[model samples]
Target: MKAIVHVGLKPGVLDPQGKAVADTLGRMGYDEVHSARIGKVIELDLEGVAKDKADARVKEMCEKLLANTVIESYRYELVD
Candidate 1:
């Protein structure tokens, strides 16, 4: 099984990297882009997790280490 995790700053949090990208885009003639947000994707391979338990396990992983829950939010998808 494979777990794909998407982690990003919460809406109220500041994102310097995203802001930089947006500024660069505007300077490069991408006037359509008003803003941008930076995020991370994490892929994990599992060997023995049951389908029913996958969600809980992945959630735990995010809460424990994958994401900084205080300022970051995360969502994940599991695939076989």
Candidate 2:
């Protein structure tokens, strides 16, 4: 089984990296891109677990180590 975790700042949170990316995009003539958000994607493989169980475990991993819940939000997907 495989799990994909995406972590990012919640709405209203300050994102300096996002701002920089947006600025660069504007300079590169991407005028329609008014904003951008920087985030992380993590992929993991698990052994001997059902999809539901792996999903739960991946969520736990995000809460315990992969994500900072106070300032960040995370969503995950399970892949066979």
TM-score versus the correct structure, for each prediction: 0.91, 0.88
lDDT of 1 by residue, 1-80 (tens): 99999999999899999999999999999999999999999999988879779889999999999999999999999989
Global lDDT of each candidate: 0.96, 0.93
State the TM-score for model 1: 0.91
Q: How many times do residue backbones clash in model 2?
A: 0
Candidate 1 CA-lDDT value:
0.96
Q: After best superposition, candidate 2 residue 22: deviation in angstroms?
A: 0.6
lDDT of 2 by residue, 1-80 (tens): 88889999999999999999999999999999999999999988888998888878898999999999999999999989
Tell me, by lDDT, which candidate is best: 1
**Residue pairs that clash (backbone atoms under 3 angstroms), model 1:** none
lDDT score, candidate 1, position 12: 83
Error of 2 at 54 (Å): 1.7
